[model samples]
Target: MGRLRHPGRYRDERRPERACRGRADRLLALLSGLAPYVDARFSLLCHSYGSVVCAHAAPLLAQTGVQVSDIVNLASPGLDVSTVGELGTSARVWVAQAASDRIGWVPNVRVFGVGHGRDPLDPAFGARAVDVDDAQGHDGYLVAGTSSVRRLTAIAVGTGDAHSVLAAR
Candidate 1:
């Protein structure tokens, strides 16, 4: 799954999960249609609230036979799941957040049943940490000259391994 045009801003405040869940549903239909063309499971690279959309969609993709190889969550506020096990996929889960990114300050709790959930960066959360020390801020992962982009690119193309990708604290 490549980057999707999210259309507008991130999650909706009125009913966040419903919105992301709806997107996930739509994502399933899209992937279902593309399933015939996919020779192997594909990977996903998501950032910010987009990660929320992915978190909702990941497991459902498997039911539709659109297996995912990997999931890279970048500077996310939350993934709506407390554990990688909850994602229900064999795909490797990776997390990346810059040392200076303010997203680290977001409370790792859900509110009104629709807020951010577990901190994907938390070692206990079980996502493979990706080094982004070269990243300056939340959106800096893809910025030029950052080690984040280099590693992300490799992961996208299937070259980087968990052992080679830099680890974040």
Candidate 2:
């Protein structure tokens, strides 16, 4: 539900797995609707549960010919998948979790299909990791004046990688 050019927020405190699935469907539709207006592939920047929506929609987007160049997840508990291969997309996947963020303690497990899967930052999850040790907290990834924002911007624009991008500047 996120486009790199624009960012938005969603609130769903009473979250449930069933509701998330519905949101993923809607997100898929919205992206599909906007695909025609884009001159290039989509780069999704998602945080928290929004990462779950992106993860669910990514493979569907691929099947429907929506070219997604990158997906960057911030403070994500899980993407509902144990590994990148389970995501079923060719887009480069990135995950950033601040060291002080408490979400790291959340177990990436599915109890009767009601939980997010493996922690996205887990080494076995296979996403390009973004170092956000300087971020203030879980919600600070996109906050202006943070180092993570700079690295994230570079990745989204496809001009750089996580480590070398800012150094080249």
How many clashes would you count in candidate 1?
A: 1
* Each prediction's whole-model lDDT (CA): 0.81, 0.75
Q: Which ranges in model 1 have alpha carbons more than 4 Å from their true place? A: 1-12
Compose the digit string of candidate 1's lDDT tens values, residues 21-60. Answer: 8777777787788888877767788888788888888877
Locate the minimum summed-lDDT window of 10 residues in model 2. Answer: 1-10
Q: Kindly list the per-residue Cα lDDT of model 2 for residues 43-117, writing each as its tens digit.
A: 888877778877878788775556788998887878888899998889999888887888888888888756787
lDDT of 1 at 118: 88
> Which pairs, if any, clash in model 1?
131-166
Sliding window of 10 residues with minimal summed lDDT for model 1? 1-10
lDDT of 1 at 16: 72
Backbone steric clashes in candidate 2, count: 0
